[model samples]
Target: MNWLTNWIPKIRSTKSSSIPENLWHKCNKCGEMIFKQQIEDNLLVCTICDHHERMTAKQRLCAFFGSEKCFVVEEPKKYSDDPINFTDKISYKSRLKKYREICDSDDCFLIGIGSVEGKKVVALSMNFKFIGGSMGRALGNAIVYAADLAVENGIPLIIFSSSGGARMQEGMFSLVQMARTTIAIKQVKEAGLPYISVLCDPTTGGVQASFAMLGTITLAEPDALIGFAGKRVIQQTIRVELPDDFQSADFQFNNGFIDKIVHRSKMRSEIIRILDILD
Candidate 1:
């Protein structure tokens, strides 16, 4: 009995099986715990509340074009990585490196060429994981390049926008992207090709002010926050209390700011339908 007690103590002291992190995810809207795999199986939308979760750029491309049909376009070589040599708490270059490693991306914007329901399209998706998907020289270059590629191929252009705003690190260089992207969208429209903007959660700031709102057919995920300025900023400036759902996708849709509030599951099909109609 004494020997058995000693053996039990030794076994207890040994390493125990560790539980995997991120096995379960809490739904941001409903506060329900759901299996992570289940969330992925449902296209990253919460099973309980149907709240659309943010997705990576690659995930978005795969969702729309499937793994086989999606091919990432090479980033253009014309833009400076840190255009203004800016720095804050950390050097802008260091921040870029950190995010690049964490996100496994060259920049926030990922441009791809893919086919949706047999129709070719140039797709650009923003990775909010990379510094809130802020617009800068890289993003501006990507947008212009995507637009040019779409026009050259005579294919539709699709953008999945998930951003906080322009990158403040780059100062005016970041703000210039707003105009650049807008011009890119205009070029796409001038070519008479469909330009679809899919606003995911938290599309705001300079992004919302520019190309995001210029889509020929704009669509948003349910409950997405799409606005130029933050709600708090607007409320403070106007000195009036805003509605609870002020910048929500539903609110924008109701006010005719966006074309539709689409469920995550229906987004692909809806885009395909719109493409067919445009064709």
Candidate 2:
């Protein structure tokens, strides 16, 4: 027992009573404090309670694959920044450059296949950190690729959707991506493969209008804000008192907008079971 106890670090002395400073992140949904690195290792899940934190597309992909073996959906072909160059907003080139510096990628989505709890499947990961995971050309392309991969590999697909909606900078072309994504997912349904979508915090706009809702099974993290318009806008439009938790994950679950409200700890295992049922 003494030998086993030797591994514990010995404290030289008690320090000042002041609490140690810990870095914190303000959750978009609940406005809670979240520790940074600890959350990363825990699938970006909040440690205090188990709320699913917003994740970047890259971080999400890495967690899903669990390694690099997952086939990457390479940068799309026929993609261009200036679908229509406009000086009214930031120039296409400048916006791209800014996003590139922050996100280090042009795409808001990553689609590919790999094993999770021993079941193989295709998956799409949306990065909330990147321009609010707006569904632009890159996102639409990734969805299409995931659907195609499911058809090609004979595996079901799962998408973790956390986005704000369309990329307005791209104009009408951005809106078109919604149609393209919906049609692409139709291929998966036609192929007789299961398509599951896990909606995290704040899945809205063009994404909500299209593929996010098309999933045969739509799952949402508890208390996520799932809607098209801001709460303020809704109140202004309706001119009435909204429910205490209107548009929240729990509300959606009760209203049939969400199929299931899942916890972060059980997510991977739940996905595994879904894949098993499909197989």
- In the range 190-260, model 2's lDDT, one tens digit per residue, is 99999999998889988988999988888888778899888889899999889989889998899998889
Candidate 1: tens digits of C-alpha lDDT, residues 1-279: 799987986776563545566799999889999999999999999888888889999888888887734675657766667878888899999999999899999888778897777888989999999999999888988899999999999999999999999999989999999999898899999999999999998899999999999999999998899999988999999999999999999899999999998888888899999999999
> Candidate 2 has which clashing residue pairs, if any?
57-127
Tell me the lDDT of model 2 at 139. Answer: 79
Global Cα lDDT for candidate 2: 0.79
The most accurate candidate by TM-score is 1
Q: What is the TM-score of each candidate against the true structure?
A: 0.93, 0.84
**Candidate lDDT values, in order:** 0.90, 0.79
Best by lDDT: 1
Model 1 misplaced stretches (Cα beyond 4 Å)? 1-19
Clashes of 1: 0
- How close to the true structure is residue 67 of candidate 2, measured as C-alpha lDDT? 59
